[model samples]
Target: MGQDAFMEPFSNLFCDLQCKIYFLLVGVCSALKLTVPPHTIHGIEGQPLHLTVNYNFNTTASEVQIIWLFERPQTNPKYLLGSVNQTVVPDLEYQHKFTLIPPNASLMINPLHISDEGNYIVKVNVRGNGTIAASQKIQVAVDVPVTKPIVHTEPSSGVVEYVGNMTLKCTVGKGTRVVYQWMKNGKRLHAGPNYTFSSNNATLLILPVVKEDIGNYSCLVSNPVSAMESEIIVPTIYYGPYGLRVKSDKGLKIGAVFTVDIGEAILFDCSADSNPPNTYSWIQRADNTTHVIKYGPHLEVLSDKVAQKTIDYMCRAFNNVTGKRDETHFTVIVTSVGLEKLAQKGKSLSSLAVITGISLLLILVMAFLFLWKRYQPYKVIQQKLQSRPETDYRKAQTFAGHESASDDFGIYEFVAIPDLAGGSRVSSQSVPGSDFISGQDMLSTVYEVIQHIPAQQQQDHQQ
Candidate 1:
């Protein structure tokens, strides 16, 4: 309880200290204060300008005074105007230009000029219990509005690429404290190896102009009050004939070689990328000699009319203005591929006809073979067997004559058996020699030999 009592006095002291600090802040908030919304402002020449100020004070004032003063850099301040309650007073030198009202603390200047640009001070004073004074400062800038800019190029006739120089100058009719900038194709441009600018950026110079330097250019001029851009200007530059090439309407191209069908008429076009369009010439090389054949961009060649099967051709592009030239070479070959294609079509049809004819012949041969195999062989064998008996009987009769005794000299065996019922005697006896044989016996023996021949032997003999 004693400790708590001791701490209560310290708490009261802390609260009293907080109350004093709060009251001090309240006194500061109620003091006379002056404020200018913008610390700096820009104005155009020959225009009206206003310096606004706000002020408030808690003390009751019997009189209120507002005074305005102007000062330049490193110069003493000069009185411009003042107001007491509702009455206004201005300096005799600037009485008609400066205006003010009492308790307003604001000042106005009509017909602002470049010489009138400076710092302005507004002071507000209240007098009753004591004088409460507050002041604020404002910076003013005056500029002449920029007019439309004009750009002029040197040697407007034109320039040759890589052989000429160019210059561009920017000008404004009426402007003060102005700045200049250069634009190319609507984008800001900077210094480059080939491009330079004047100290004020009002002039641009191109050293040894090139093809890349050709573009739309403009100049932009501005001041604190106004800004303007000049009309777009394009500089003419003459360049060479580039990327020379040749193209044909009907041909098979491989690199620089063109293969055209025989008897075909092909049209070739020579072209190049150039500024002023190029003049073309066609040259043909044959038999170790070259000569210009045509003087235009197009040439028609008949494959059959060309003397040589393979030929060399050239397309020359010339730029008259720049005195530059470029050329490309190509080869043309006359071929029979189209005729061969037609022949191949005919051969394919002929081959199909031949194959069909051969197939029909093979079918006929197979049918003939089937007929021969089924009926012809049997008739032929029957005819041959029917004639076999007559042929063998005649052969046996001839052998019986023994025209050459040497042929019948070999040893022989003969057997005879009689038929019991027919009364024919069978002889199991050896025959006499050829010299002693009888005619009847010979005849019978021959008949017997013919009857004894094997059936297989007769078939073999017939075959």
Candidate 2:
């Protein structure tokens, strides 16, 4: 039983090893599929290049034959390099340039140049279990790197729109198999009525430079290996002072007439669509004549300063480069909400008020003086005399006459004269038949005035 047990383990070990070998064969068979990825390759000039292939076989091969061929359009395949088993055979012409490794089919080209660009064919034949064949073709391209290009314009000076011709040329520093394309304002440009191109599309000719041709232009240069673009340039073209008009900052503008308040200031701006900015001049027209009022793009008009309330004005815009000028005429109207008139009226009222105030003050002063003169001078004396006892009554006699009181109130005049020696003299004058009291009668009446009663009582006392 012990001997059988030892032999059983060894038998099982042998069975497992056979099974592993069976799976290994199956994996090797699956790997036999040949693969050649990226059948096309690009290479730079004066640079080394490579092309590769992959293949496998389940069992060891007695002989492996690899052959490489070169072909172009409408041409038979030409031999390049090959290997059989372990020996390498290369064409004498390209032996030093192209390298071929056996079993692993990969090619290397030293110092690739522009002339080595074409289709390449690689074939590998496996001799195990019958002759098995596999082949792949790869396309190769060689190119010199593109350099920065420059653009030159004919007639670099300013060209008038629709009158002059212009041409643009693109040149590269160094490149191989380069193609050129034109771009305007960041978009691809094509031939049109005014645009023509050279044979290689490297030069662009504009028969007539229009206003639309004034834009940014550039050239795009490209090759299989690299691409480059030229610097953007803007061509000069002179345009007109088009779409000219006038606008104001402050006013009621209808069509061309501007209405402004009497004392208001308004600013007028003149503008136009032009290549070069226009120089503006403001002109005032009066009595069928015109004169320049200001010289600038902006004009400030004060309504009060202008003599004519309603006037005609013009704004002229001239382009120095294009030699073109445009003029627009407008009427400026002054409307009366009567603010200025109201101000004048207010001034008159103020003057009249001042005069009336002065007159009133003078009249009041004169009235006060008249009242004081007529009564104030006698009141103090009368009061003092009345304060005394009746002892003065015999000296003062009272007269109760109605006609005496009526005759005392009247207008009196005073005159000033120069004396004979230039001394000043003042005299009082009263007409003889005037309704006024005489000096002596005034004294007597004043003495009796303190004892005044009613008029009827005075009349009765007289009777």
Candidate 3:
């Protein structure tokens, strides 16, 4: 019975040892099932991104050891930092920039720079009964955040009507899964009848541009992480002159007359209301011909050139696009000294007036001379009849009787004939016995007497 008791104690001790071994094996199996494989960490190149290493253990342990390592493609692994229990120890090189807290199995990098990028390894050991080890490798990929996107238009300026299409492309330095949105006047725009968006949402197209399409436009670029906007761009649109009118620098003068004194220079301006400024040409009408003097909005004419009594000038303005033209006519009348000279001299007057006046004066003078000459012929006949005697009177009677049948004596008159012999000659005594008719028949008798009178007496009367 004493031997049996000693064997039972030893057997109990052996059972206790087997139970401990089974428990350790079970713990190992559970740890293998719960542990996670290594994974790569992702972060932006110039921004803070956390790197986490997850691990599992079968039993809760009071103290654990964690070590983090880093390696490049062709370089050896470098020890970064380690943690025991709740305390962390970091490599002197990166201690100030990188931080680690135990139990979390995570690492934080402040102001992550490009140099801290590569593959990382984490080794963990749980202290319970005997130490158990677990390890995982994580890859850290550092990338740069996308820079401010730029939107470029095919033709930076706006296009005219009936021109080709317009395109806007949004460009970013570095980004993934980007989206672009086009905005006009702070409103989002969608693809419509004339607008189309590209597949990647990076480009926007406007098929045709109309007058109403002018506005402030911008492009917005975004990703899951960040968004950026471009500066506003305004495009120029060209149009035409629709309504046109004239405006003079000096308001419209009465009758459109610009009066200036002699030797003075005057400026006349012509302006029209149009989309594009109109071209102007100054025209002057001289000697029945219209000529272009100058081309500009303003025209200056020296009064000395306008010596004439009245001068007329014109301004012609035209639109190249519409091919429409307008003209304004103005007259400058120089009434000071020019009109006076033209009137008094009468030198420049037409020929018709001069010819008519000379003709009337010549007719009046010729009538007076012819009337005076007609009486002379009658006086000579009267003198010849007064100087003859009775013997001649009978001869004259015979001639008178023959001519009296056709002569009208009532229209004839006579004055006494004067003696040419110093007023003392008795021509009356010589001719007293001859009966000279003293009536209308006297003129008939006188003409008859002159035809038959002797040549001696006729010569005495003519002397």
Candidate 4:
């Protein structure tokens, strides 16, 4: 019974081994019937190249062997290198040109040349139960010519004249054995006298560019098999307003000196040739004070604000980039009214004295004329009376006297008169004298007689 048990365990072990061998045979047959395609490799001339080989093996093998072969057009294939398991064996001719890294089934070629362009085949063999073999091929191409190049400048546009340095660069797509050349207006430029090329021949530099240097520039790229030229590029430079001019703010002033009222304001604009606009300042020489009023192309000043009768004003223009400046000066004269006042003063005094004298003389003349006119009428009447001497005084008196007392009597008295023979002459009552009359006694008696005579004559005639 103990022997049977030991034999039973051995029998199970033997069956397991036989089954494992059967599966291995099936895997080897399957691997030998199929193959994995290889991948393509690409690289530029003078650059590193890497190639890969791909495959699969279904075998129960402890080790596998791989071989690499290289062939060019119109040439027979030759062994380049081989790798057994993890060990490598490279052909003597290609030992230094090619490298094989184990377990990856890949190859690397350093400093590849155009001549190295060809198809490479990798083969793999399995050494177990039944032998299996597979192979893959990859094609490689090399480029020895550079692609088109591009050129660029620092500043894009609006460059002023005569300024500073400028830099330009040239670059290529991809190439082997490449060379660069810089050209301006179809002429080749060299590194000398303010012109410089970069160490790698990829850049061109110009120091203190002037108006003469303005033109189209290009970068030329060349390789063994091809050459290319880049588009033109331009660099900008900024400069100056070398000569500046000054005038009134309106425009070119006709007169070099501007005349203005004392209490008015004036503006002066300064213009010049420059990349950026120039700065302006107004300077006035009055009371020995000098300072900046404002900054720009225009400067303003209030003339009346200045104390001096005659003042000098200057306009200055400056460019910060060019470190240059210019100036212009003008004079202003102020007038006074002193002379006009003096002339008017004499005329005013003379007019006042003439008016006063004429007024007094006119008053005296008017008084004398009024007095003579008043007395003239009375004198003329007296002359008329004296000329009429034929009129009797008594008859005139009777004609001018009152009527007889028999007419009517008021609360008054009357005297009777006789006939013309004068036997009993009636006496007439005398009118009483007014209070305004005052005279001597003799004059009073004459006045009484005069007053009674007219009445008495009338009464005598009536009788």
Candidate 5:
């Protein structure tokens, strides 16, 4: 009872001091103002942080003093540091952890750890004839940064399509206040009919697995200070044999039929979209009977090797896990039409070449005839002259009465011949001094001149 009675007065005195400080803080707002921007701040562990206090006073500050205090949950405020007239005095135990620059009551905490998270208080008092006081408060938080995350998948071996459930989890070694995001095939995953997320998205659940759910998955974790991403994880899911089809490299394919040249080799490819890839089988229909001829994704068919001219083929795909199957039907039609068409084309080309050659020959002949007819008369005359023997000419003189005037040079007389009953009268061609001369005389003169030249050439040869 005595101890309780003694503490009552001290409690009342504390209440009185608190009331005065509260009134003083309210009163100084008009004359002096205090401010702390960002009343709350978050910091990373092992990093530095700063808490600022801004103030302004209407009157001149003769002497200024600043005090800093630290408080936590359900605990009395403790003194950390103070400044007077541009000088700082900090607690010895925390001298290295806290800093104070006087006149501007901002605090700096270096190498901040988790223990530094708390509320901090600052008080400013100016002393002179008239004094005013102001104060500001700031809350600080420290956290450990997030690290690289890793993803883990349940039933890692595999899962059957439409009959199994899958779960994905994200794990990290070191972090505080971490968040998680799920991703598949580089796209953000969303909660849907087939998917559900845990509280923080650290875990993803797939109700029932399907082919659509099979993909590379990852996780991203983040916090205020740091972020991290997980490695990729691929979940195996067995599915069906879908979109089955047959393909060939060398053929004219239309509908399900392929037309290949006779004696040519054709390769057929069978495929489908399935997990644990589909087992392929080739079927041949011959003589109204079907038989499985081969087992593979590829088949080689030789047109001439098969007995039938037109044969039907089938490609079947089976999924061993899903127990589903699919098939495609196609016909391999063997024909010699490719070769026959080529032969006909060759014949047509040969005939066309022959006709072209004949037409060219005719054109050349016509051009030659046109040139010959244009100069026919000149050509005939030249040929006649060229065919004559130059040595056969007899040296004889003809009448040249036209060379001078008729009075100066006597003109030649042209005598007309008269017809008779028994014989024909002769006309005379002779050189005339004044009148015509006898033909017999002119003829003998020319003959004698011609005979004399040969006789002179023979005598020279004999000498």
Candidate 6:
């Protein structure tokens, strides 16, 4: 009895294995085969849905049958429609919804709804070889079309650079499984140091606004069925007064210096790159003092009205919202450029070249005059006399006693002084023969007779 029980268990196991082998052979040798591409299919609400299936049989069949079933998760399959040869029979509840044409295993659903979204099972049965069957399952998903998205900013008015934060949120009216994307000037944007996004990528946050963050922004929402983009929106970002400069209408500008012609009216415009247009001020600096001369962007100055040859001016730009300021300094030189310009008309030689030549000529003349004056005999004598020491002046005064007589023996200048007796006397430390003469006669001597004395006779007298 024990050996019989063991044999009985082995027999049951052999039978079970034979049954499994029989079924496997049947599945492999079956003439009918069914193929359904794209196991998962997506469908839009209110749109026609098609589930495609292809079937083939090797043997010619007297009758062909195609059956379709619908099932949800953890639910029993429900019959949708079936076709025998060329005749279609649909379930009474879904007669108008499901459609299937002749001998084909594919099924169609018109105006598919959310409730119709489920797994679809198609079966093909051939009646020639005692009902050879093949089946395939396809999953269907229903979604509403993605609507156009709209973006809204936290502060609609504006935000200041580096002082305020900004937020952008995207919203959709109707959609399922919608994805969000941020775009700036037609390019996709990603999270950065100051930029962040929500989990669903619908909201964008700018921690601190800056000048580089200003641009046209938009939202793109898409689903498996449709895609849409919102209208462009520009966020106002108050920025600084950058690249400040001054421009003149009528002047020759070289770097920061503007050369203006005499009697010409020059208009200066102060400008800068900024948001919320900057307030401008024109300031004039002279004699180490500065004062605002104008409040507008434009300043008109006549060259004749300027008293100085060169004047310093400043252009200041201030942004009230951003609380930033920038300034530029320039110089205006008044010259007789009007006449020079007139002379330059239709002439190959520019006025600048003429001015340069004249300047060089003047400098040469001045140098020549300085050298000539430095080496002149008269100037040399004057400089020597003025630079003499005090003791030298005392020695010169003692020339009447013949002290330092050799030093005073060079050329001498003569002068006459009127005396109290109404006659003129020769003023000098000493004369060659003056000691032998009395006072009235000596004083009466003519300047011509004294000057006519020969150098030989003077030397002889000196010896």
Better of 3 and 6 by TM-score: 6
- For candidate 6, report its TM-score: 0.68
What are the candidates' C-alpha RMSDs? Answer: 17.6, 16.6, 25.2, 25.0, 15.0, 15.9
lDDT-better candidate, 1 vs 2:
1
How many residue pairs of model 1 clash at the backbone? 2
- Residues 312-415 of candidate 5 have per-residue lDDT tens digits of 99999999988999999999888987844355335445778889999999999999999986777455545644553433222111122232223333212233
Error of 3 at 114 (Å): 3.6
Please list the residue runs of candidate 3 whose C-alpha ends up more than 4 Å from where it truly belongs after superposition. 1-47, 52-63, 69-79, 84-96, 115-123, 130-152, 169-179, 185-203, 223-225, 238-463
Q: Candidate 1, residues 7-102: lDDT per residue as tens digits?
A: 533443464454456447654324677889675689888999987888887778898877777889997677777788878877788899998866
Candidate 4, residues 92-149, lDDT tens digits: the string is: 8889989988777878898898888898877666667645565666887776778889
Full candidate order by TM-score, most accurate first: 6, 5, 1, 2, 3, 4
> Per-residue alpha-carbon lDDT of model 6 for 1-463, expressed as tens digits?
2354335334444644544565587653356667897657999999999888888978768998777878899976777777889988777888999889876677889989999888887777667654566667899999999889999999988899889999999999999999999999999999999999999999999989999998999999999899999999999999989999899877778899988788889899988999999999989999899999999899999989888879999999999988899999999988984643444344456779989999999999999999895567456555655665654443333332354556554434344456799766666545554443334432223222334455554454456
Question: What would the per-residue lDDT of candidate 3 be over residues 232-339, giving only the tens digit for each residue?
Answer: 876554443334323333222455775455665667777775424678898889899999989988877676776585788887878675466778788876445543
Pairs that clash in candidate 5? none
lDDT per model vs. reference:
0.77, 0.75, 0.64, 0.65, 0.75, 0.78
Error (Å) of candidate 5 at residue 49 is 1.4
lDDT score for residue 336 of model 5 = 83
> At residue 197, what lDDT does model 2 achieve?
98
lDDT of 6: 0.78
Instruction: Return the TM-score for candidate 1, rounded to 2 decimals.
Output: 0.66
Write out the backbone clash pairs for model 1: 417-426, 418-426
The global Cα lDDT (0 to 1) of model 5 is 0.75
Q: Pick the candidate with the highest lDDT.
A: 6
lDDT of 2 by residue, 333-370 (tens): 88767444345335335778889999999999999999
Predicted structure 3: clash tally: 1
**Model 3 TM:** 0.38
Off by over 4 Å in 1: 1-30, 73-76, 339-463
My TM-score estimates for the predictions, one after another, are: 0.66, 0.60, 0.38, 0.32, 0.67, 0.68
Instruction: Supply the TM-score for candidate 4.
Output: 0.32
